[model samples]
Target: MLRQGVSTRPARAGQACRGRPVPFSGSRLRSSTACGAAEVAEAPAAAPAAPQGLGDLPNVVSVLRARGLVQEITAAEELEAAAGAGRLSVYCGFDPTADSLHLGNLLGIVVLAWFQRCGHEPVALLGGATGRVGDPSGRSTERPVLSEEQIEGNVSAIGALLRSVLLRNSPPGAPPVRVLNNLDWFGPMSFLAFLREVGKFARVGTMMAKDSVRTRMESEQGISFTEFTYQLLQGYDFVHLCREHGVRVQIGGSDQWGNITAGTDLIRRLLGGEGKEPPACYGLTFPLLVDSEGRKFGKSVGGAIWLSAERLSPYKFYQYLFQVTDADVIKLLKMLTFLPLSEVDALQAAMGQPGYVPNTAQRRLAEEVTRFVHGEEGLAQAIKATEALKPGAATQLDAATLETVAGDAPSAALPRAAVEGALLADVMATVKLQPSKSAARKLIKGGGVYLNNAKVGEELYKLAPADLIDGRMLLLAAGKKNKMLIRIQD
Candidate 1:
């Protein structure tokens, strides 16, 4: 996920507060313990950031623990014991806030995937029922409720996107991920019946103590009864999964700790009674994925960096991963990829040392993650699209790939004659890359305007018949990142 307004000097990746450079001798990132890095001080006091040099580990929990993925876990010993016993069914729920999951949900997905790789059953629960009544854990205000038709549509689309990525990462013969819509169970029950059976176990005192509830309660926009009962609904979902499918563990983001615990508690109360004991159940959460500035990653001006290629093109998705800050790249690798931690440590070392090639690890992070989510073919498309925009790509890029990569910037359609005989400035203005012809000429003289991926060297440079790339198209770029595809009609 791309943080919208972060500025980090890559040259200072390994600098102490005193500005002295530290040699990467295969150890901690900082040389002097005296200067606690901004990364250390900036992280939340409750959840400490993962330490450097996180090599591969013995078990899933240990790997997550080393990678700093585990922020809060209920009954650590029992969770480990259950997982070690073999074939633990672990799940994480994704509420279809939109038709696609974003970088915000990547941590939970990756955690479930790691368990699946180690032979545990992964149950990806899509919240078809809960989406209609939004979860308020991270929101400052109440969410806009959608129609059942809209939520149901989002559920199926999100389910397909989720399954594509999770199953691609699964071993050939491994148990295919068990996907369930929460509405399957909740749909059949009456409101009164639900209250009598499931809602009865939820105590008011325990509910109010939840930070999400307490904060919303004290706010000017008091939470609605529908939203207040959300946790109860979620709690029963856990109990339902546990009883039917033998799924005893639930994992989610740190903000979901309250709801996750609610589920765990419900599991015990419903099953355990006089002369009977409850089964072992647990909840685990991953820390917030934040940059050094403490702003959540995966958000740009346009919105979230989405998991679905249709929502956010794979080319743009790869670029987002490619732009991750040097400071966060290694940690992101551990969080997002199943790459051996030793390789990540080496990449971490290289990132700290002198003469490190810019974007080497960032590219690897993009490739690994892109391949995992979008598959080999999608990754290839991303790479092809990336290269088609580079310098001297006028005749090199075919028209089809050019159109695909143009998803990055605005595009316009014009007649072939509009580009062939007009001055470069006029064409740039025509495409709205510049406000006026004069402004376009100014940009051209300053060597900021590009036609067909080639920089225009002169203010008066006129577009010629030859400028139509591959005899029929033109790609205009204002700078390195902003590209506009000029579709030329015959």
Candidate 2:
């Protein structure tokens, strides 16, 4: 069996909240309360709760609860109004800086898919233009600038993956998924025109006040002006969407709260400034997926566990889910899988019961998620690989399958003569199992090393040809992060 490793990345940061100006910005658009009491006093009081039809919208709280991620809704009344309006236009963005979305991005994509299913028009925004100016929300350092050609390639690849995933999960006759590149608008956008129109209202101090910006300033790596203006650029995107597509809601990760709100505020200000009836817009942020250990979801030492098959193989993806802890499994099932409530609850309870390991639940979770993204064929491969590795399962697997799995893993080759009558330390050393002789001895004494899928003991089990399941191969595992395929050639 392949030993799996635990992975972690940084936790996603702050989300936008209502009535509070973003945590970092200065008084940009003077609020009535802070700007002028007379003007504020004369303005209309906060509107009363409007009637809501959100229950009629697709997936609602049930999906949110299933994912175990908090849906930080703007307001009940706001959601109701949008639902009643028939086809609430909403947009979510994916930066094309990366060729593929990772598991962390899956939640956002699923949310958009569900929104479309619920009768809201969904817009997939490819941050072609904004991506040129990196978003600083989650970054500790500035991203290296990409060439124009690289950016275009990333956008194309990302779009293909986005279309594939959304089409797989989306129901028939759901709002048609529209793909947009911000570059279309921004490419032709002139600096003078932008300054005269969009930039006038977005004050520098107000922009700097965001937690994303504040965090950047305090960080040793420092922030760039391009990254700082990312929110404003995002705000302008909302205005563009509002005017062009009637999109009124922007949904994103909680770290995107500042940007989402900027878009909403832009809509309000732009329309009001021009003496037009202000178009209504709403913002919603979903909580970032974090494990029980409090680390951000996605990433192992091998690097990001990507959705793209090219980046992360289906077998590896299945193994990632299989390694989930009991505490995180149910939460993941809810967030990542479409398993029904009754079934999920039963599985959760079973996992908690004495002597019940979470393997079955994890496998089911992995299967559902893998199938949803990669389809039946993908799941079949995962199952096949799993069966090939499980104890007592080797005989059922063919030589080709064994070779395929072994070939995919990091490998070592040894002469048949060298393995015979060798100390376990020497065996470990020959295969580069440990970096040094001392470490190899420690591993042998601690019984942390395995030979041919079984734990090695006595530190001196001499290798024999009979121990090779296929008369050629040996599987060695070091802790959970390392797997070495060894072949004894004649």
Candidate 3:
């Protein structure tokens, strides 16, 4: 998620306060120790601002501060009230459209973890039925409807990943999180019963008023009835959570404001019965993360960077974070990391300075995040693969590490008959490289083509079976960066 806003510098450190303590709070405490007869004031106390309740939350505090939603009562008041109420239930729905959750959904996952930290029970809502319908939060077009088996498979896969990630970060002695499939409830629900019970509280007028719906209204490709009913399903999710699980707050990206508020409204109507506090439900939405270029995160020239190792390798995941621009690193560190503000400020300051490089910061962010989502082993493998990117570097990587780096690269074998007298272009093209003979010729001419780890100088360079590094594999490189492996067989 890309957060908005960036001011170059906001005055120098110690410019205002020389003797006075700087107001820094949260995880920014300075520790001191008294050694026998020698007392030391470890580090100067950066007089922390008043400790906010949610500020104690690991990453949610960062999200709230970064999104500027900390001041919103509907957001904070609800969080505070939930904690105060002692195990007030809260939830954020997860639609299992894919095998694994991606970096795009990290914020929501972080929110669930934060909710749990604040001493509230978090219900992980796996959208078994709704995944079939698709939530139109950021989608430009309607997602393809999945078959029951496919949805179920995705739901199971995603549920396992979610449980693994959330459980790893579960605060010590915090409320144990619960994972619930909405399909469990919605599966047996009949259309008539749904309309009478859940659908009755949701109004068409309110649904149409949603920004997601409104955006599609003026377009030639209008919103579908299936998508429009998304709000109703989401609202019903909250209602079910409240009725069944005692969930009262719905947190999501700002785009979910409509659906979240709709759920709150439904809870008020159905459960409140004439507006007597209405279970004190609340809706909190974080700003959708976007970069300075205005492009969304977790997407690139490569496809969506997913969290699942099967869908996206931890190496690739680390690479994705490693590629964060200096412009986005500070914002990313603040949003994605549990690092202290002083440490974050130091990183930001390092990035802003002339000689200080951002690569170290990038690596730190990547390692911390990869370790958080994946295990230490995943981080280690990614580190090895990262080291492998260097010239003349070869590391013994595990199968997962190799697969992560080789992502979609094709593994093809050219027989002896095919390898003899083959044009480098033709050989490379067989593996879907260059796309066309003309493109291949252009790359060869521009010195962007290489074979057997060496540049292809001649246009008609022969790709003989002898060029194979192993019994069949030949290392190919296009330019100094792109690499591919080709094989020859009997």
Residue pairs that clash (backbone atoms under 3 angstroms), model 1 = 1-298
Tens-place lDDT digits, model 1, residues 232-288: 989988887776556778999999999999999998899788878776788999998
RMSD of 2: 14.0
- Candidate 1 lDDT at 187 equals 52
Per-residue CA lDDT of model 2 for 3-118, tens digit only, reads 01001100110111112222223311111122111110011124321123334454443455455554666664666555555556578999877888898988888777667656
Q: How many clashes does each candidate structure show, in the order listed?
A: 1, 6, 4
Which candidate number maximizes lDDT?
1
Question: Native-vs-model 2 lDDT?
Answer: 0.70
Clashing pairs in 2: 24-209, 25-209, 52-80, 66-334, 67-334, 67-335
* Model 3: per-residue Cα lDDT over 133-252, one tens digit each: 888876778888887777778888888888788777765656556777776555555667677776777788878888888887767888898898998889888876665445667888
- Look at candidate 2 and tell me the lDDT of residue 98: 85
What TM-score does model 2 achieve against the real structure? 0.72
Considering lDDT, where higher is better, how would the candidates rank from best to worst? 1, 2, 3
